[model samples]
Target: MKIAILGAGYGGMAAAFDLLRAGQDVTVFESAEAAGGLAAGFKAPGWDWSVERFYHHWFQSDAHMLKLMDDLGLRHKMLFPRPKTVMYHRGKFYPFDSIPAALLYPGLGWGVNKIRFGLVGLYLRLTNNWQPLEQTTVEAWMRKWAGDSVYREMWEPMLVGKFGERYAQQVNMAWMWARLHARTTRLGTYQGGFQAFSDDFAAHLRGLGGKILFSTPVTALQSEADGSWTVRSAAGDQRFDRVLSTTSPGWMARLAPQLPEDYLKGLLELKHLGAVVMVLALRRQLSPQGYYWYNLPKSAGFPYLALVEHTNFVSPEHFGGDHILYMGDYLETDHAYFQMSQEELLERFLPSLARINPDFQPDWVRQSWLFRTPYAQPVPLLNHSRHIPAVRTPLAGLYFASMSQVYPWDRGTNFAVEIGRRAAEMILTDGQA
Candidate 1:
């Protein structure tokens, strides 16, 4: 069987590997010059390791990604480090990584509020069933379980920062539950970098007789009457026995117009929050207490949502003694931030960096890069599961897999790999049938 994958991200690459292993000819198409999608990294002249365009880290519980590493003989490169995570509130930053930190932290308040916050965390961690939780909004659920003060002081700012004003209120509790359950204090990263791993994975797939076309975007897709797929790109058009699209639902709809109108409507109805990240190579570290991640409350007056010092988590030694920091914000497509240049963004955020460190200055920045994506986060609304499209579409020989489909688990590379493999299995089963 011949298969065509619509993207070269972790999900598409995973599906390509699975099909190739099963003796199917596979070709993957990627719009970017390199692979890894959101996990893709950028390297500077003096840097020995590539840094992700957007900040990325894996949890200790990312079983699918861990297993993929083991299978690829790259498990030894995985490193888990306990990095300090802090929260900024009322003009001060405090440690918020562990339970003790939460209890001691001043922002969450004292007595019953703090106790309720801890109990809510435990409940989210312990609760396995997400079906009931899906019906409730995060705002409502948090107010009920942890009270208004905890919700307002701790969660509301973060939610508003991420989801924006339009959809923040509609965010479901299941999404929050998944986020709380899936994360761990100990964060994981590849020893060299994620890009290094992705490059190696692509090489291994090529060794298995799979072909990947970088910088080649699939412009259109059509379903032939004889149950085959015609994938068109600027390069040319090629028919495949099966086609699996790992692009976002919005992108898939545009690429494959032959899809049913109802399916296209479903795809269009799925809203996503985009991201803009400014990666800075600094002469000195920004966080005074060596915090890796700092969640900024809305009251901080910063333009960005969070401050992630990548070198604080990984070592500065990898990047020629320069500290790496990522200031990221999630916004709707029409947000004004997306239109701003890197220089403009820096101008807006540089003062916030100084606020974190009084001695900080623009001269400390050695180099900087800006990255933007239109589909960084899928907005999980009330009963989002019912709206999630099936892996197998209505058209035979055409399939879909995306981050939006990885519901009740939050979107991540681990679930991307899982959904990719699931799509491959469905195709293989159809072939058997």
Candidate 2:
């Protein structure tokens, strides 16, 4: 049997690896020259240190990722540490990660609001799970728990920052549950870098005789009369008994319009928020404890929404005692922030830095790199379930393994890999049936 997987992202790579293990011929096509789509890493010009454009970390619940790393013999490099996360509100930083911190948090009032917030969170963690969250929007859910004041002061800004204008009134509850559950951890990263897992996965696939074609963008797809799909790319076309797509559903609608009109419409309707992350390699560390801090109640015209003092979480010595900070913004593609030049973004970032770190100066910045990923995150609005396209399309010889399928679960390497494995199993069984 032959299989073709599009997009060398986690889902595609996972599907390719599993199919190869099943003794099937698998080929993966990636538009970029490397694997790890959104998770890909880039090294500095002269340094061995590398980091992902967007931050990535693993939680204890990410079983598939942990298992995959163990199987690949990269377990030794996996480092699980008690990472610190804080929140910035009213020009003050507050620790809000641990349960103790939650109880002691002063930013939130000491009244019904705090009690309601704690109860809702506890219910979410202990009972509701992610399934119930799917049926309601975050707005309604939050209002039910507390009130408009809490939502306005605490939640709305976060929603806007993460989802841009797509922070619809009816954003899905499942999305919030997944975010809350999966994120309850100290976080872990590889001793080398998060990309190490991607590199290892690609190498394992190659070792298993799976072919990966980089710089290959699938422009069109058609199902032949012979009950197979022929995927055409810049390189050429190939016929596969089974086809799986991990590309964003929006991109899928553009590449292969064979799906139903409504499905395609939903894909088009699915909104995404873009991001521009400016990474600064500095001569000195930004924060004292090297904690991750999210700027809340986003100030007007701030260049970045959050400042991740990575060195605070990880040792600066890892990057040769130099601090690495990530200042990121979530904006619409049409937003001026996206079109701003590197120098313009830099100019805006400096003032924000001085606010957070009074001693921050231009000379402290050794180097800066800007990264922009279009359609970076999907906004799971209230009716998110309705927006997700079916995995098994009406057409034959086609399947999908996408982040959209992991609806209640936020997009992650672990979820993508599990989805790929599940899709592969279904495809194999369907073939036999």
Candidate 3:
């Protein structure tokens, strides 16, 4: 069977890889010039490695992603680094990545709050039962079990950071559980970065007789009377035995007019948040204590959600000893940051850096870049799992895969690969039938 993959993201590429291994003819259509989708990156002239436009890292528990690299014979290029992650509380940053660190942190104050926090964490870690968690809001669940003090001190700030105060209440507990349960202090990345991994993945697909068309945006998916699907792009319309769309639900609704009205409505109904990020190449480190992730809270007068020093996580030496930092936030599509230019955003985000490190100077920043995406996070409301779109759409021979469908699990590269391969298996099974 000839397969067409719309969007050369990890999901699309993973699906294509599986189909190619099954001796199926596969072609990938990408709007961007390269692969990795949201994980795509760029580099400086003197830099040997690339940095992502949006920040990305893998947890130790990201089995699906780790397995893929090992299978691809690129394990040696992977780096697992122990990076310090801090939470900004009151006027200071406190180390809070591990259990011991959390207990030692002063924000929780007393014994009862600490005990409640530990018990709730133990429950989340020990139980594989998460379906019920989907029905409960993180706000309610944390308050009830972890108590108000623990929830407010440790979790509420992060909720505000990720979803803003407006949508934070609507977020379910399962999403929060996955966030805490899946991550590790030791983060993983490729030697040259995620972009290099994507390039290698694309090259590997091509080597296996799969065709990847870059700078080709798929405009529509139409069904032929003979049962095949037509992919219309800038190049022209081409027929395929099966087609998979790795775009957001909103894009899927836009691209496939042949889908059932009910299906299209469901796709349109999926709620999501966009991201605005400012990446900087600096002459000196941003965090003096070598902290990698700073989870900022709006309550503390932070203008953004997260402040990640990528160079601190890995090493500045890989990029000609340039300190790299990312100031990012997840906001509604209409947020003002989306409209702000690099200079405008810098003005808003930079002053806060001095609050972290007193010596931070504007001159420390060498170059800055602004990146914004309309679909960065999928909002998981109560019983969100039930609302998740199926990989097999109502239309025959056409499948859907996107970050939105990665419900109960936060959108990231690991689940992208997992769903992509799972969808590919479904397509092959259908082909056999």
Candidate 4:
């Protein structure tokens, strides 16, 4: 069987690898000149650094990703970086990575509030069943233990920032369980950077007799009455026994118009949050605190949302002793900040870093770049499970396996790879792949 996988991101790559292992002819089509989709990288001008187009990291529970690295013989390149996280609350920055920190953190109160809050976390981790809570709002779930004061002062800001106002109130409590499960321990990165994973994965795919076509975007996909699907790309059209799409749901909805009208409408109804990130290669480190920091600012004054001091987490020597900084923000595509030129965005983002470290002069920046992802994240509204797409589409021989299917589970490289493998297994079970 000839299987064509669209989008060479984590999900697409996983699908290709799984299909190849199943003794099927597999080919992957990537729109970008490189694989990795959102995680792809490019060379910076002055510093000569190679990094991901967007910031990415793997959590402790990312077993599938770890297994993939081992299978590809790239396991030795993986390194666990112990980076702490600080939350900016009410004109103050509080370290909040561990239970001890939370207990001592003043922003969340010290007496009954803190004790009750800690109990809530214990329940989330201990509770094997989370379905009953899935139907409940996150606001209600948190409010139950943390109380209204702690919810408003500590949790609401971050929730609102991640999922816009409309969806913030609707997020499932199970989502919090997944988040806590994944983020319990340390985070992993490659020896050089995440971009290294992309390079190695592409090479491994080629070595396994798999074909990958980069800079080739599939313009359309249609299934014939005879059950063969034709994938039309910039290069040409190719017929395949199966076509698995790991691209954005929005992209899939546009490309596979032959899918059921209800499915298409469901995909179209799902909204995504876009991101604008300014990555800087600097001469000196910015934050004195040893980790990533979320700057709330004076209530959304500037476009900058989070600051990642690359050197603080990973060694600067890995990038030839250069300090790297990332200032990230999320917005709708048409938002004013999203419309700003790279120069304008950088000009606005730099001052925030400068305030963090007085010594962070603009001249210290040897190179800089802007990465904008239009459909980087899905916004899960209240009771989002009903809207989740199935693994199979209405059209035969076509499958949908994007991040949207992993509702309540946040989007990440780990989830994408899991979804891909599961999608392939489903097809094989049905005697398709």
Best by lDDT: 3
- Candidate 4 wrong stretches, greater than 4 Å: 45-49, 295-302
Ranking by TM-score: 3, 1, 4, 2
Displacement of residue 405 (Cα, Å) in model 3 is 0.9
The TM-score, computed over Cα atoms with residue i paired to residue i, of candidate 2 is: 0.94
Model 2 CA deviation exceeding 4 Å by range: 128-132, 165-168
lDDT minimum window of 10 residues, candidate 2: 294-303
Candidate 1 steric clashes? 0
Candidate 3 local distance difference test against the native:
0.91
Residue 105 of model 3, lDDT score: 91
- Taken over the whole model, the C-alpha lDDT of each candidate is 0.90, 0.78, 0.91, 0.79
Whichever of 2 and 3 has more lDDT, that candidate is 3
How far does residue 301 in candidate 3 sit from its true spot (Å)?
A: 0.9
Candidate 2 residue 309 Cα shift, in angstroms, is 1.5
**Tens digit of per-residue lDDT, candidate 3, span 267-350:** 999999999999999999878789999988889888888899999988899899999999999999899998878888899989
**Candidate 3 residue-wise lDDT at 299:** 91
* lDDT ranking, best first: 3, 1, 4, 2
Clashes of each: 0, 7, 0, 0
Clash pairs, model 2 backbone: 133-174, 170-382, 171-381, 171-382, 172-381, 172-382, 290-312
Give the CA lDDT, 0 to 100, for residue 305 in model 1: 91
RMSD of each: 1.0, 2.0, 0.9, 1.9
lDDT of 1 by residue, 9-87 (tens): 9999988888889999999999899889899998898889999987888999999898888878889999998999988
Instruction: Tell me how far candidate 2 lies from the true structure as C-alpha RMSD in angstroms.
Output: 2.0
